[model samples]
Target: MSMWIRIDDGVATLALTPPADRAVFRTALIEARGAMLSWDVASGQRFPDAEIHSPLEASAWLAEIYGEEIAAAVRAAAATSLPVPGSAELVDAAHRLAWLMWASDWWPAGVYTPALNGPILAAETAVAAHAVEHLLDDEDAVERTLHQAVDAPSALAAVPLRLRADAAALLDVLTGLADDHGIALSAATVSTSSADWALAAGARGQIREGIEIGHGLAPVRWADVPAQTVAADSDARWSLRHIDGVPHLHVSVAAVPVAAVPSTEAPGTEAPGAEAELWARFGPESLDIDIPLQGDSVGFTGNMQVAASIALLPLEERTLWIRDPLLAAVPGPAESEDDRDAVRAQASIRLDDPDASLAERAAAE
Candidate 1:
C-alpha cells in the first residue's frame, strides 16, 4: 500500500490506499511538509498551510498560498506520487518541519520565554535547506550547514533575543538530523537526546515520587519465589511516607514479568490471557493498585491504607506478605521520605530546565 496527498477543490487531503503502518504514515506527513517547504524555498514565497481554507474565494486564497507555478507543481505531484527526496537537505527540512509541528503542541512558554515563531522557523528551515542542499556529500556537511545557517541573515537572526537559545537548540537538532537521517525516520525508537522524540514516543508520563532507601529496613529474601516467574532485575519494594500527616505504605514491583503469578489451571487446561488473569487477581478497582505494564516488563504501584499498623510493629516484625493468588513480599529495604523528596525535586527541576546537567539538577523532589 502507498500513501499520497491530494488537493481536490481547495482542500488538501492525505489518502492512503488500504492502510499503512505508523512509520509509513509519519514518513508521508514529513514528506508532504518537506514538499511544501521545498516549493516555498524554490519559489521565494511564504504560505503556511494553516491559513488556507476552502471558501467562496478559493482561487484568491489558493493563489495567495501556492501561487500559480508552485500550485501546478503540487497538483502534478499529487496526481503522480509524492517526491521522496532522500537527500540530507530535504531530510533536514523534514526534521525541522516535524519539530515545528511538535513545538506547536508542547513548546513551553513562560513569562520570559515566548512561543516559537512558526513563520520565522519555517523561513530559517528554508535557508538551512538551501545552505545544505549541495553539501550532502561533504564529510563535515552537518557542521558546515549549521555555521552557514547561523551566520546568514535569515529567520534565525529575526528570532527574539530571549528565544534565541531555544532557536539555537532547534538548529542543533536540525544539524543532528542532517548528520543522521535514519534516526529521524524511526518513530518507534525513543531517543533521550531530543524532547520531541520523547514527547512523540509518550515517554513523558505523570510525575511520581522516586524513593531510594539505603538503611532502616533489611532485605527480605524469598526462597519460594521462582526465578522464571520474575523478570530480570525484578525487585519488590516498599516505602513509608507521611502524606498530609497520615502514614501511607507504598508498595511497588519493578521489572516483574506477567508470569509472576502463574495460573492455577489443571496440568493441561487452557488458561486465560495474561492481562485477563492479571486483572482478575490485581485489578485496580479490587486492590486499588496501578499496573502500568504496556511492554514485557510488568510493574505495580499501590498504597496500603493500614500503614500505621504496619509502622507500629517492631522493625523485624514489619514484614509484608501476600498469598493465595501470588506469594510475594517486600524483597528490599523500606524507602525513606527524604530520599523520595530528593528524587521528586530533581524531577521537577529537570522539567523546568531540561538542558541542565544531571549533577547540577540533582537537588530536588
Candidate 2:
C-alpha cells in the first residue's frame, strides 16, 4: 500500500511521505480546483478555497484506496474533463469510498501505534486516514468503508468511535456549569456517536490548525449531528457534553451524539420521560436541560436559570417538543421553509438557560 504521513518532533524539519506523487489525488484536486474557479467566476459568488479543496483532497486519497478507475472521472477533470457529477455529489462519493476501506478491515486500527495521552484523538483520525489510504490499492475494502460511512447508527457497529472516555470528562465540566446556571434540559435519553469527516482537495476547503479539516467533518455541513453526554462509570472522571449548542464540540476531533432515543415507554423518540437528562447549550457557556417525572413538572440545575413556569414535555411528545423550540431559533436569512426545516430536521428541543445566546457570558453575566 502507498503510505502517507508526517512526523514532527517540534523541530525545524518534518518527516513525510513523498508529496502525493503528483498522482491521481493531486490530479483530481487540480481538476476540481480549475473547474471551481471558473464556476465561481461565472456565478460571481466567491466559493472559499477550502470548500473547493475539501472534497477534492478526500477523492485523491480515495483513488489511492479503491482504484484509479474509481476516480477516473475526477482524475479526468485535471487534464481534460472534470468529473461528470456536481461538486456536492463528488464530495459525498469520495468519503463513502475512503471510509469503506476501514469497514472491510483493509485499514484496521491495529497497524498504527496507539497514543496513550497526548493527541489521542488526532492520532485516531490520522490512523483512520492512513488505514483508508493504504486500502485504496484494494477494491474490496474501498467498497465496505463507503457503505459504512453512509449507513451510521445502523446495523453497523457503532465502533464506539465517540471517544466516550474523553468526551465524558468534558461533559462533567459542562454539566457542572449547567447546574450552576440552573439550566435544565428536557429529560430525553440521548446517546452520542461520531464519523470521521475528511475531504480532499476539491472546489472548497477549510483550514483547521492550519491544515484543512476537509469537507467531510466541516462544522456547517454535518447532518444528523447526534451528540450526548458520556454514560456514568464509577472509575471514569469523564462527563459527556450533551448540549448541542457548543459549535466546535462535535466537529473535528470531537465525538457527537446523533439521535436521542427515548428510554422510557414511548419508543423511537427523543423525549424526557422517567429518565430524561436533556443537556443543551444555550450559548457557549449556558446549558439547558429538562428532567422528567411522573408529575407534570420538570427540574433544572447547573449555572443556568430556568423559569419554573416553563412547561415540560409529556413523555411521548418530549422529543418533538424540544425540536420546535430549536427550530424557532434559525436566523432570519433562511431562504425557504425547506432550508429552515432542514435545520430543525438536524436538531431537537433541549431546554436553554434562557441565557443561551452566543455571548451571554460577556453581555450579561
Candidate 3:
C-alpha cells in the first residue's frame, strides 16, 4: 500500500517504504490538528482503538478513505458536542467542515485548528444541523450534502474554520475588542494518551482554560478551598485557569539567585499519610522574573485562549528543562514519566528551601 504522513504544514506527503507504524506515529503526533487517516479503506480490527489527545496531538482517525468519511468519522467520534452556542452556528460549521473534506481530495485526516484557519464563521455555523443529522459519519457525504444544500463552498479547501459572524464571548468581561460581545467561556476538551499524563501535565490545560483566548492580566485567584485563603502572591501575570475543578495557581515569580538549598525534606520512607500532601508555607519562593509569553510581559494580563501558544512547546519537545529547567522534562520524545517525577522532586526540594540555588537543586538531582 502507498504510505503517507502529513507534516505540520497541511500538505499530505507520501512515503513508499513505511517504517513508522500507524499506532506509534499516531501516538507521537497525537496532538496534531487537521489530522485524519484512511487506510485506502476501513476494515474491521478486532478491538476498537481510540486515542484521545489535544487538538495539537489528537490521533488521526483511521478511515477507509480520507475525504468526507474521515470527516464524518471524526464528527461521529466528536459524538459529544462542539463547544458551540446557538444551533444555527453548529449546523453551519458542520456543513462547512464537511465540504472542506471533499475539496481537500479527502485528506482522510481530520480537521485540526490550523486546518480550521479561521473561527467558525457566522453564516455557516448553523450549516450542519439538519444534513449531518442523518448521515452522521461520512464527512464526504456530509460535505456533498452541504454543497448540494447550502451556499457554494469556496474553491480553496484551506479557508480557516468560518468564524461565526457572531463571535461568542469566551467571558463576559472580554468586551474591549470587537463589538459588545462575550460568548460564554467553554472548556476545550484537552486529551492526552495517558489520563495520568493529563493530570500531571494539567498545568498545560490551566493554560488553555478550555476556550479561545481574550487578553490582558486576567485575574486568577487561587485560594485553597474550604480554607478560602488565596495565595498571597498576586500580581499581573499570565494565568491559565478559571474557577473550576481542583484549584491550582501557577505563578511565575522572579528567579532568586541563591546557593546551597537547605535540605528540608529528608529523603526517607515517611509513614504513609503521616505527611501532609501540602505544606502551603512552602508554596514556592524565587526572585521575581516576569514569565514571558509571546514577547512583552509587563502589561500582558487578561483572558487568553486555552490553546494559546506556550512558546515553549517546540523547545519542550526537545527537553522539558529548556523552558523551566526546574520543571521535569515534559513527556513527549526522549523522555519518560520519570522526567515528570524528577521535576516534582526538584520542585519539592526547591520549595522546601526557597533560598537554595536552582543550579544546586538541578545538579543534586
Candidate 4:
C-alpha cells in the first residue's frame, strides 16, 4: 500500500507496504528484486566511502517481498565472521552478502554507504579490496580493454554480483592451475555464459595473453589452453609476432563466423539437410578457438567455419543474416608497409568487395 525511500547517515533505507492485489504486489516485488540485484553489482565496484552507508534497512525491505527467511539469510551473511584475505570462500561470501543486500533493496542507490558502525564498513572494504586486487592483478583485463585500439569490437556490461561470485570461484580454480604450470597471471576475466576467460602472465616486459576455453558448455582451465582461432575467413587474418623476443601470434579478425554444429551423421554420410538448415545455427558468444592454420591447434580442430562459408552455400530461400560480432585479437604493431598491406588485405575479406584477396596483394608486392 505504501513505498518509501529514505537516506540517513549515508545509508539509504527503503520500506514498502504490500498491496492488496496479489498480482500487483508480485509485480512490485519483481521490480524491487531486479533493483536489488542491480544495486549489488554496482555497489561491489567501489568500497563504501564517505558517501555510502550500509543498507541498514535491508532486512526489513526484504521481509516485505521475500518474507523473513531471505531477510534472515542476508543478516546472517552480514554477521558471519569475515574471512582472511586471499580466502576464496570468504571473498565469495562477502560479495554474495553485499549483493544480497543490494538485491534485497537494502543498499540504496547501488552503493554501500559508510555507517557509524566500524565492523560493517570493514567487512565491505575487505570484499571490495579482494575483488579490486584480483582485477588489478589481471593484466588481460587491461589488454581486453586495449584491444579497442586495434579496432577489435568489444562490449562492456554491468556485471551482476552472482556473476562476480562465479568469477571469483573460477579464479580460485585457475590460480591452482597457474601455479602448477608456472603460469603467473597478472590479470584475467571469467565469463560464465561463455565458460571461458582471457588471462595474462609473464613479467611486465614479457607479458603474454592466453585464453582458457570450455568445451561445449563445460568450464575451461589452464590445462585446456593453447587458445587459437579455429574457424576463420580471409578477413580474420593472423600473423606471427615476437614480443620482447618471445614468439606469439598476432591475430586480427574484423568479424568471426558462428561455428557449425558438429553433425552426428556417420562419416561419409550426407545428412539430409539444406544449406539453409546449416547456416541458421549461431556460434557461442565466446568460442574456444584452436586456429585451423595458425599456431598449434591443441584445443580445437576441424573446419566448422559456419559464419564465413554460410554465404557461399546454395539456398532456396533468401534470409537476412546480420550480426555485430565483436572485433577480436592481439595483433602487434605492423613492421612495414608490406606487412601493413598484408594485414589490410586480409582484414578486408569481410568487406563486400569481390576483388578482396591476400594472394592478389602478395603478387602485386
The estimated TM-scores of all candidates read 0.24, 0.21, 0.18, 0.17
For model 4, the superposed segments whose C-alpha errors exceed 4 Å read 1-96, 99-302, 305-365
Note the Cα lDDT for every prediction shown: 0.31, 0.23, 0.23, 0.25
- Residues 108-205, candidate 4: write the lDDT tens digits: 11001110111122223233333333322232432332221111001001122323443344335444534544444443222122211112111112
Instruction: Quote model 3's TM-score.
Output: 0.18
Q: Which candidate ranks first by TM-score, i.e. highest?
A: 1
In candidate 4 the C-alpha lDDT for residue 79 amounts to 24
Candidate 3 per-residue C-alpha lDDT over 1-365 given as tens digits, one digit per residue, 9 for 90 to 100: 22223222333322223323442111111111333322211121111122222222232322322233333334444332112112222223333333333212211111110011111221122233232333233334323333331211211111112211112221111222112222222222221121111100011213444322222232111121111011112222333343353322333211111111112311111111122121111111221222322211111111222222333234222111113122222212332334323323433443244342221111122
Worst 10 residues of 2 by lDDT: 229-238
| Candidate 1 residue-wise lDDT, 48-131, digit = tens | 222112322233223333334434445444443342222322334444443333332222222112223333333344334444
Which pairs of residues clash in candidate 1, taking residues 3 or more apart in a chain or in different chains?
A: 344-365, 345-364, 345-365, 346-364
Cα lDDT over the full model 3: 0.23
